[model samples]
Target: MLPDFRLTDRTVPSAIEVYGIQGNAQYVARKAEKQALYAREGAPCVEWIPPDDLASVQLPPAA
Candidate 1:
């Protein structure tokens, strides 16, 4: 499992920012086509947030 460095209870991200949204049909169509291709290939699309963006993701104190 990928760790959430935000120290959040969010199991999954509520939103993801996609690459482009210039309102151009061709661009949007190409992006969708690529997504479909990846899906058919059983590839997973993932997003990322730098660890530095979060407050803390340190190891917990030992008991």
Candidate 2:
């Protein structure tokens, strides 16, 4: 018999820093879409799957 398992939870952050309002909304939508797609494809984890353009950003040093 197959072992019982529970899916991991992936939740998007409530706020994001983008160039503009539209960009922030777009980013959130993209994140949600990716999570849904991975869930549909039966992914065990979503950490390794980076979102598009996310890897290209360079953050400033922490004050």
Candidate 3:
């Protein structure tokens, strides 16, 4: 079964923001599939870290 999904478009100066909602939906779908597979194998699913923690990670410069 697929999870419920929604999308909203917004005008923004950045290309990233324009595409952010679609990107987020893709991420959720991927994570949900991983979680479902883990559940089927009787393995613990990893919890997502809070956004603040994610934001604090130092990412390499974008190519």
lDDT of each: 0.43, 0.40, 0.39
Each prediction's TM-score against the native?
A: 0.41, 0.35, 0.39
Stronger candidate by TM-score (1 vs 3) = 1
* Residue 12, candidate 2: alpha-carbon lDDT: 28
Instruction: List, residue by residue over 23-62, the lDDT tens digit for candidate 3.
Output: 4778777766756765686543224234435454332233
The digit string of per-residue lDDT tens for model 2 on 1-63 reads 111222223242111223222447775686567556656866433232234466654333322
In candidate 1, how many clashes are counted? 0
lDDT of candidate 1 at residue 51, scale 0 to 100: 37
- The most accurate candidate by TM-score is 1
Instruction: Give the higher-lDDT candidate: 2 or 3.
Output: 2
Task: Give residue 19's lDDT in candidate 3 (0 to 100).
Answer: 15
Model 1 segments more than 4 A misplaced: 1-18, 47-63
Clashing pairs in model 1, backbone N/Cα/C closer than 3 A = none
Per-residue lDDT, model 2, residue 32, is 67
TM-score of 2: 0.35
